[model samples]
Target: MDGTVDITMPAELEGTRAVVRSWLKSVGETVRRDEPLVELETDKVTTEVPAPADGVLLEILLERDAEAEPGALLGRLGARAAEPAAPTAEPEVCSRQSAAPAPPALEQVREHRLSPAVRRAVGQHGVDISVIRGTGRDGRITRADVDALVAARASAPASGSRIVPHDRMRRLIADNMLASVTTAPHVTAVFEADFSAIIAHRAKHKAAYERDGVSLTYTAYIVAACVAAMRAVPVINSRWHADHLEIFEDVNIGIGTALGDKGLVVPIVHRAQELSLQAIAARLHDLTARARSGQLKAADMKDGSFTISNHGVSGSLVATPIIIQQPQSAILGVGKLEKRVVVREVGGVDTIQIRPMAFVSLTIDHRVVDGHQTNAWLTAFVQALESFGD
Candidate 1:
């Protein structure tokens, strides 16, 4: 059988239009089985369309930067060159009138080898797979490679004014943020929290935590406090369903990690309420590390009942009305920790004291949470931090 195959888009990219970023293999070039033939970029990720079988690229139906839908034929491949037929003795008119069967249509197959994260990155950037230096086993492309490419592109200085295109992640983040604000009436309640106790506790246990290979950060303490608060007020750990509110039994906290100009990703710590302070610290450390390294799995970003954006890491003083992650009732925003003067009563005399303090804000979905509930959650959070022991 003459081995001719049609290269189509992967099924995972359904419902999305991808731009033909670039072709790694030109027509007449031989492509090995599973070798990348072309790069397709979508809004969510950039990925390569691999050759189904060992063959030579025979034709290209879509050129670079052309828009294509899922299952659209991008090109064709031939297993081998067609053999020449024997000379026919029939007249030219008789040969023109001869009936012959049409060739069979090529089968449509989806690429099943790419990981979800890698696929997302591919569709997002329309990356040129050939240009990427893969560090994975067997020379496979990983999300980190795509991120490196993105970072390099971002860092390069442009010679003139140019419009930079948004990757899939950025576009999705924008759409989600816009939807969150439009879907729910957001109200933020700010509270000044004394972090002296938590800070002292961390300092005291820092040695032991480091010995155990965990860096005890203030964010861990905040997350532990959030778990306590969530247990006390389950509504804060709930989602707003169309007909009713659904409070989850387990607290899955999403810690927002900023990816420079790439946007943000919220990787969740599942069953956070069941974990101890040390466990929470270790897990948060792992998740954040993986998040920044572009190693987070799809599950790492799922089932988040609550989200915490610790904007303070970047020296943000305070962020008001931080948009609540959709479906979740609220999001916690922690500001930079600093020393501040406070008035205290000592032996019935007014005394001034410097304390480590941070401003905490809780932005809630008014549709599922009320002002009283918001205040209650913040109170519990603050109390946990102030009275923190061990």
Candidate 2:
């Protein structure tokens, strides 16, 4: 006796919604247990759902581009050599399965990966897409992929003009950015932070941290500073609701990791308030490596309460209004770390000094917090960095 295994959408989707991006295995195709059976795309990330058991794909409940709620049935896998009964689930999808539903058309499945942005660009520009090669994920076309072609056609193109587009990811990121700026009243407050103490601490412990397999990153210190700031202004670690404010006790910090020209992903270091400096560094190292290699899971990008954008790594001195991630009240932006001339009081005497410093800014949703709270948070954050013990 053999029973069908249910394959369903993941219950803990970041946004509680997903679209069936593609069916990796067709109905009637034999698959191994744990094999990737389908792909689902949420606004946060795209993830592959695996087969529940070794069996033949007996039915597809959700076709490509169909919306799915958490735990909605995606398909059914029947035990090999046993024909399962017509699944009582979503019978409407049965039409896709006739007596012998044909596998998805090769071109249709591939073309579906092109985002509406790409489609619109193709129509708007009237460029022959066939001649241009795709540089996006899996070699799919992207708006950036299309733009480079148009730029090449121009009479004179500037240096470093091409941008890499990773199709769906880029499109979703753009939409979220547009919505955030439109919905939230953004206000940014800038401050200068002295990292002299942190630099000294790292220099002393870097070798020891390396021995323990941790990189002892500056980000670890930044995260610790953020937690300290959260204590000073708890509202910084909160979300805005129409009726009230929802402040969280846990400081889940999302570190914005850039992937060269492919944009960035924010992987949260959950409950940062409880993590030690070494532990924070370790997690950042792992999450960042995985992010760049395309190995991060959907869960890695979920449930962020606050975010930190270390934009300084790319050489920018500062970026104002680094758009706040929606729902979250604020985002901390760290600019390029460079030594500069400054005035310091030493033994009650003020004198000129050269110190390593970085410009930091807190971009907040004015509806959620006021300047007093924003400035208070930045002051606390800088104090944490400057007051690091020798």
**Candidate 1 lDDT tens digits, 271-324:** 998999999999988988876665565557767889999998899879988998
In model 1, the worst 10-residue window by lDDT is 104-113
**Compared with the true structure, what per-residue lDDT tens digits does model 2 show for residues 1-390?**
188888988766735567776666667888888776777776555666888888998999998778988779888998787557887776455664468867877555656766555677777888776676654345566555677677666634467565443455567789899999999999999999999999999999999999999999899999999999999999989998989999999899999998765668899999999898999999999999888776677788888999999999989989998999887999999999999999999999999999999999999999999999999999999999999885
TM-score of each: 0.67, 0.78
Q: How many backbone overlaps does candidate 1 show?
A: 12
lDDT (C-alpha) at residue 322 in model 1? 93
Name the runs in model 2 displaced over 4 angstroms.
Answer: 82-166
Candidate 2 Cα lDDT to native: 0.84
lDDT of each: 0.80, 0.84
